[model samples]
Target: MEGMNGRSVRGVEGYTRWSLISLAVGEPVLLWLLLHTLHDGGSALAGPGVAVLAVLVLAHTAACIHAMIAALRRVDPDRGRRGLLPLAATTAAVLVAVVVVLPLDGPAEPVLASIPRASAVAVIGLATIGALSARWPMRILAALTVVVLALVTLTQLGSRIGGIIYLLPAYALVLVSMIASFRLTVWLLEVVRELEVSRESHASLAVAEERLRIARDIHDVVGRGLSVVAVKSELAATLASRGDERAEREMREVRQVAQDSLEQVRTLVSGYRATDLGTELAGARAVLDATGIRVTVTGSADGASPAAQDALGAVVREAVTNVVRHARATWCTLELGAPGGRGAPGVEDGEWCLVVANDGSRGDGAGPGTGVDAVVPGNGLRGLAERLTPLGGTLTTTRSDGVFTLTASVPSRETA
Candidate 1:
């Protein structure tokens, strides 16, 4: 008992430290002392009676061990519903052990006085383990355990009510101590398990927060720089058409803006720049809607590969910017969906599709066509394509009837 308490004090696993050690070491040692008491006190069992009692004790010990193991197995979450069978076996064994040691043939089969008390202790200890492993609201089992042990002790000690009064207090103390020890072990195990779960949750939350920070930094660095460059490039084109000297200066400004953006990108990448698909999608809808473009977003970003998510997010950012800065149309649709599914045409299996289309192409500006009628791919579109190529994806642009559409497709893992 001291060793058990000491091991627990030093923080050992509950089921192992308490249940295994107690059943294997504690029960045997206690049983030895109990059997010694029976022998020393002159038990008058002869021949077959002695052999029967020995067998019963062995069986009871085995049953108790099984009960302890079963209790430990169901210590957590399950609350030891599976331990009930072992508990019953152990209880039955204890009762049999009691009957074997009792004076069933009156004075001729008189047993040692200590044998019944020892059996009661064994039964109570098993009951304590059962109580510890069992789920909540086991008041009935607890009451029954106490009543059964008390009755068993009284029946065995027949006409020894004075001895019962003297020994009962010590037996009660033993029972209380057993119960308290088991409860403490169980509580400690729960706390340890909870702490482990909390640690894992904290780690996951930290990773998500870091990802969000990186995404925000990339957005701040890239989005502002790109939007400014677009506006300046448009201004430069207009000035050059009007034969203004400021056109050359505006072109220089555009070059400087591009250089600055390149530097910003390099710095952000060195700091591990990243973006979340969901965040980028939400931002695209907000920016496009504010620019008087009817933005319709469909599908979800869940279950997509991390590489694909990053690529699609970049596409969303670039496509929305192009529509706002260059495309002069009113309606735009963004769809992120599974490929080779309903409403999707020309998309192969194991692929996720991102389609951004706008009917805002200004005829006077660049519109999709060949030679003079063709709209050339800009820096944004080119950069987006570069990002997708490494992820085993393809990007294509089409313009028909003044509608400009950018479609991106990346392979995806099948979900379980």
Candidate 2:
């Protein structure tokens, strides 16, 4: 995805660069027409004068193309400096060509004189539009229209008002169209670049979020088991010192816990670790009972769909882990049913709900109805919320009196 987005952005940039270069190259064709006109009009300097003019037009075209490439690459920091030579060359060429051809006597003299000047303006405008902002090219175009009209009027001695009127709107329309095309292309290229950056940022965020998920899963899978192992191992050592026969059994239990934790970690890393609600409930009961905390489970996991069961199982695992590690309760109650009975807002009839409530909460400075925010820190419950939210579920926690309650709900297959 990242590579494709980057290539798309680069493609837009390449297309824009070539488009600007094409415009720059094509605009000078008008200068060639001016040369052809001079030759056909039988101007005396058409021989060497045309050659000089041709050289000037070629130089202007080369400079304009170079300026446009530089601007598109954004390599030259001083854009105005980069465009200076092209603008200067075009100005000198236009003045020389116009002055040399002004004395020609023909019905086409005024129109012919205006061609070199107007074409020079267009060439310089295309060049600077690439290097500079749209406003600079617009100013140059405006000046081109004004200069062309004045030259046409002065050359005809104001006797051709019809020609001036005809040329005014036509020149403005052509120049505006060209400038708009260039500006819109550049704008589109910029938008593509921004989209590429945004795509990269989103990819980075996804990576960070995944890392957080793995960390949370490791904690839920391994932390409480390690705590149990430590407690049992210490008791086993004491019982061994006392020559108790049960010490061997406790050590064996520790090994089993370690093995189970190792398997869970492997499965978690492989991304196929699914939690069955019934299995999770049994494990929660066994883990809590081993710690001398009474566990009561209500409601069957049968009616719920696999997705809802998996999500609720994660909630149960994390909640049980928190109860074992963070709370001092003598008892924990696990319940599963429809949230409609509990009057949970926005919960439909077919939604499966899991409630884990324990009395030994250490308070942890969390307030009542704190939802995900007031839960024990470290992405346990928060990660479960992240998991459930995409399934149209919610995770919330509340600390009231001496109990910390975690409630998770998800839609069943029928409702989903």
Which candidate achieves the best TM-score against the true structure?
Answer: 2
> lDDT, candidate 1, residue 350?
75
Candidate 1 lDDT, 347-402, residue by residue in tens: 67779898998987655534335522444678888888887777677788866667
What lDDT tens digits, residue by residue, belong to model 2 across residues 1-416?
Answer: 22334446677888987876776677557656655665576645546766676666667667666766666663444553566676566756655665574342434565634343443443444444443433245676566556655654554453444545555566567666767877788778767766667766865886799889888888999998899999999999999999999999999999999999999889876565666789889988877765557789987887677788788888888888888777777789998885455524445676887888888866654454542235554678778888988898878787766787787888776333
Task: Give the candidate number with the greatest lDDT.
Answer: 2
Candidate 1 clashing pairs, residues 3+ apart or interchain: 329-360
TM-score of each: 0.47, 0.49
Q: How many residue pairs clash in each candidate?
A: 1, 2
Cα displacement (angstroms), candidate 1, residue 319, comes to: 45
Candidate 2 Cα outliers beyond 4 Å, as residue runs: 1-11, 74-81, 93-110, 113-165, 223-257, 270-416
Off by over 4 Å in 1: 1-11, 14-16, 23-25, 46-76, 101-141, 224-258, 269-416
Cα lDDT, all candidates? 0.64, 0.68
